[model samples]
Target: MVITEERIEQALRTLAPVMRRTPMVASRALSDSCGHDVWLKCENLQRTGSFKPRGAYLRIAGLSDEQRARGVVAASAGNHAQGVAWSATTLGIASRVYMPIGASLPKIAATRAYGAEVVLEGEYIDESLTAAHVYAEETGAELIHPFDHEDIVTGQATVGVEICDQMPAVGTVLVPLGGGGLLAGVATAIKLRRPEVRVIGVQAAEAAAWPASLDAGAPVKLATMNTMADGIAVAMPGAVPFAQVSELVDEVVTVSEDAISRALLLLLERAKLIVEPAGATAVAALMEHTDLRLDGQVCAVLSGGNVDPLLLTHITTHGLQAAGRYLTVSVNVPDRPGGLSALLELLRDQGASVVDVIHSRVAGELRLGEVQVTVSLETRGPEHQVALRRALVDAGYLAGE
Candidate 1:
């Protein structure tokens, strides 16, 4: 059955007690940048740190007693695994979750903590999905497709319902696209209720499937998918969600990895929200898409917050460098100990905070008595970085980028 507005409403009411009504707050930074009122739908704070549980609960609840007894199996990168494990645990049903071997450790632990048998299989989500299907067939367990089913779409539509109720003047809504489940559900609800509201979908440039699929006029599978935004890195769009998105979504755009990192850093610093790369795609699109003529209130859905700590650290460092807040330069100096101390003094006088200093005596590029010293500094911005570099150069030091 196709997911309709009426079905979405019913699903929202049914899942209300089980799900959190995540906040939709105004984003002054985004609004100022885009020259329009921008709101953030913080589903990153939803139960299980994503919107997956809503669909998982509803899908599991719809199963018959026999089906429940037979148990359920699902494949996911992380979020959906936790969602299904949590739902199955709550319903007193057996569940087994297959996840990519490289999935986040915290997510794997959380899924297991929710009382589901965790199976680490394959290198990508599609491989894990294949394992889940095989296990389902061998054990007669119910297979829960992540984003393809009408019930799952109906459950995800609740996010759209809440967005409409929270921001009545919303002129545009941006959602991160994976297999297109969330976008399909949100678009169906918003467009059906407020036909004038424009719904746009955002995808990571590296793993985007929607643009090519839309161009082909059908669901097309990508040969390979690689992206740091693993949460929304589906190699292909789901058939059901593809149909819904094709009919309802107004536009689709892709954002680069640098844009995604910047968006995550922006959200964490300005909004005080820790969002995953996939969750920040909408915000990234808003920052990158200068052609959008948004006038009235616009909402960007922050879809999930299940990022690994190591990845967060790397992204934060990259963002700092990209913003010119961090600067690194190599300089030729005297081989004596006082030479290093003199350079540090100069940096301190220049108001540059030294993060790290590396001294090398190698003769690759240095003169007979010269040594190469690499300095990492934290500066205010690009201007400060330029000023510091000029000061170093004026001091008779050969500085390199």
Candidate 2:
């Protein structure tokens, strides 16, 4: 049950009415920076705020009446849960979703709002999936494997169809790779139609498994997975996507956490698009590896936009730090009141905006009549950061002034 051009076309036809034809947004900034005309395939704006439903809807709609009557069960980190819930409800089928306990609140709420019975279980997607499989077996319900199933991959291939149609002269397409449904589907669809076009899959470097699996010529489980791009943090590759990715994908690459944060910030600032870290992996790949010879015009798929507000704030700050636009400096000052004021005045003269300041005298390292001050300061860029730190040192604030 591998993906085929016909299957993908059928999926596109089936999903057209429910799917929003997300636009190909041109990024002048990225285009100029990368030395190519860059376009963003905004699946982040797709139904359920992701490309999940294209596959979910198609997978569910194909189930027989009896299968549908028994209801459906699924497990996901977040996006796929909402997708399966939305798709099943739209088809008048009862759905139950098992999600990791750490799944974001908004995603859980959205899944429930989509008319699915949401159960919080396990600490990660793999555990939740195990629970979902058990539920399916016990209840005799159909299990909707997020990216592992044939129908799901074929359905996700619709994004490739849209890209092929939208960007007539596209030379390279970069897709965020996780379990590989999107990559497998999109690569197959595009390669089948436009064999000349390059399709690259980008994964979160910390949790990436595809590269090792491809090297071994079989699926390999990661010892540990850690990344902010939770959307693509699969510990192991899916059977279907593994097969598709191995055979069809032109290249598989990785992007760092800092790169992902910077890419997300860039999307928010330049593209005015709110994309989750996982969704921004495609762009991150380009940012981290600028030397890739993407022959002509490039299209990076912004995969999803379901992010927690708290996480967004943290990532934004992290991005700023990674870009050298923010800094946290620790200094020792006199324990007297005027000492802190003098330090503040020095910062003011240096043109650094203080975000936060923590003054403490509790550290064991503190000398007699002295306190430690940790200041979170915002700067312009790398050069400004260097100048500010130099100014702090010159003022003796950094060396116990």
Candidate 3:
């Protein structure tokens, strides 16, 4: 049951024809910010738009013809469901998937497109998983777990092999920890090949499982986890992955939602890579640390790219706000219509791009016959924001930051 380098190598060879050998690209921005040689393992570009396909394909491929005929089933929020569905379709096996009702529309559509019967039930992953288990028992379908099985782990190990081949000088590998299939397999392969290399696993601080689980020396379940990184927002750690991670991984860290969002923005703006919140977690950890800076050649695995369009927009907007590139100012002006026009003209003269404006005369505690004006504007950076604020102050109006 042990995952060794040879087993990983074998899986890589078997999966080569079907799966993509995703790129390992250097990041100049990450390098400049972290003061180290940084490379991105772009598993976001893998088949299924996530690394899930590697394990899913390997697990189904190992099944016998009878097992395949009996069909396979799985429970997931998104990525794993798509993985199993796509793998089953390619292997000509009937598959069924149980997913939370709130699962992303694109993922649900993609899973159905891959020829799996999609059952939407439950408020969270555990509920969907419970339904999937009952269905499997009644229908006599082979259950394919997302991260807990041996074949799935072996399949995920291929990533480590590829990383070693692509970046031989790598001393540290940062992995996003979810249910742990990816980390367990990748850690096993890395330790088996180059025991000297350090494997660092990261989790979203809001939905983190490893911190408490590792402390208790067993897998612990969360009552509820709220985080934007839905991909790694696992409520509990897997039994198999916990064992492997405990033994092989050198460190486990947690990053805040703000940190993850900032990292996501950095990837999009600086690295020019589109990554989901889960995918940006590792880089978030590396960026969050003020004391423990990663040295030498470091690789951060971008786990997936399948982020909701709305969430992506929110993340980008939030990033701009966090960076002081977007600002909102409130000022009191005369009730006359020309007052609003004059204020806007002053903003234009100061080189600020207005995004939104609101004028209120009916509400709030204000001087009689005076109107409240709230303006939202976009600036180039902190300097521009400062310039706009100074100009507003010099123009004889009270402005709030």
- Best-performing candidate as measured by lDDT: 2
Give the per-residue lDDT of model 2 (tens digit) for 1-27: 377767877888899889899999999
Q: What C-alpha lDDT values do all the predictions have?
A: 0.91, 0.92, 0.89
Question: What is the lDDT, from 0 to 100, of the residue 158 in candidate 2?
Answer: 87
Q: Write the per-residue lDDT of candidate 1 for residues 1-401, one digit (tens) a residue.
A: 27876788789788978899999878899999898999999999998899999888999999999999999999998999999999999999999999999888999999999989999999888889999999999999999989999999988999999999999999999999999989999998898889899999999999999999999999998888778899999999999999999988899999988889889999999999999999999999999889975658899999999989998999888778877788998888888769889999999999999899888998476788888899999988889988888898889885445
CA RMSD of all predictions: 1.7, 1.6, 2.0
Against the true structure, candidate 3 has what lDDT?
A: 0.89
Query: Residue by residue across 305-396, what tens digits does model 3's lDDT show?
Result: 88888889999888778777789999888887698898999999989899999989876878997898999999888899888888888887
Q: Which 10 successive residues of model 2 have the least lDDT summed? A: 392-401
What are the runs in model 1 whose C-alpha is more than 4 Å off?
399-401
When 1 and 2 are scored with TM-score, the better candidate is: 2
Native-to-model Cα distance after best TM-score fit, residue 289 in candidate 3, in Å? 2.0
Measured by TM-score, the strongest candidate is 2
TM-score of decoy 1: 0.96
